[model samples]
Target: MQPRKAATADVPELIRLRAVALESLGTNPGPADAPWRRIARHWFDERINRRDDCVCLVVGGGPGEPLLACGMAWITYHLPDSRRPDGRRGYLDGIVTDTPAHGRGHARRIVDELVGWLHGAGIHYIQLHTSEAGKPVYEAAGFVPGRYPGMDLITAPPGP
Candidate 1:
């Protein structure tokens, strides 16, 4: 199936698919959490509609059909580096596929599309953190283990 750039109208489905992805990663809120749903929807809306630096892509059965997979990238600028003289990097986020749609190459296709788009946009560096199940897919797409180690400091925990 062909991957398409997501529209603002696709936010609801994208949010749902994101939950599926997060759940697979063991990081999602309980399914009945209304507040989290509202917050996620709002966040996605702003990113999809208001942000020029974000791009969301999806592959699926088409309009009125369930999306098979979805992926997103956030563009950021940094001081020029040897690999990226322009200092443009694409941070991949929220790449997920419907549970029932796994093993169909949907996630791979969307990632390929995103990488191509990033290249066309003159972005040379791309990065993402993937689950163990997802490691193979990203690896096959030409991503190597990063040279620099990554560390995170969580300043605060989420509320219940």
Candidate 2:
């Protein structure tokens, strides 16, 4: 299981995989409009290429074939004014594994590889939100509960 940075050429496949991820989350990405596709492509371009404070990785693929898993890390550097030194913290995002490849540890492998990379990049404190199904895998990777309770702000579309 090799993990590597996704390339521009991996966009279409990444989009497909993302669709699968959305399905797992119980929603479709949206209508198949050019604008939507363009938006998605732009997101992929940034995420896969680590543009704009993000680092994306793909696994199980290489010069020979298809990547079985993909993950992303959105990093925010601690400002000089902030108390924390070291200059790097990250949020884990998009740990999606192909259903057919489930039980093979594809997702875990990708995440482990990403964590190693993050550590190498001088980022040690990281956080993530996961579905119940995903919780066990993350736990197995040594993640523990945070001191603060998690919260979210839900916003609805305007103009009913």
Q: What TM-score goes with each of the models? A: 0.88, 0.82
Residue 135's lDDT within candidate 2 is: 90
Error of 1 at 64 (Å): 3.3
For model 2, residues 37-121, the per-residue Cα lDDT tens digits are: 6778888997776575677788766665666888887777777445448567878888988888788887887788778877777
For residue 118, model 1's alpha carbon misses the true position, in angstroms, by: 0.7
Candidate 1 residue-wise lDDT, 1-160, digit = tens:
8788887778778878877877898885567566878898888888778888888888874668878889998888889888889788998888999999999998899889888878888887899988999999999999999989999987877889
Lowest summed lDDT across 10 adjacent residues in model 1 is found at 28-37
- Clash counts for all predictions: 0, 0
Best by TM-score: 1
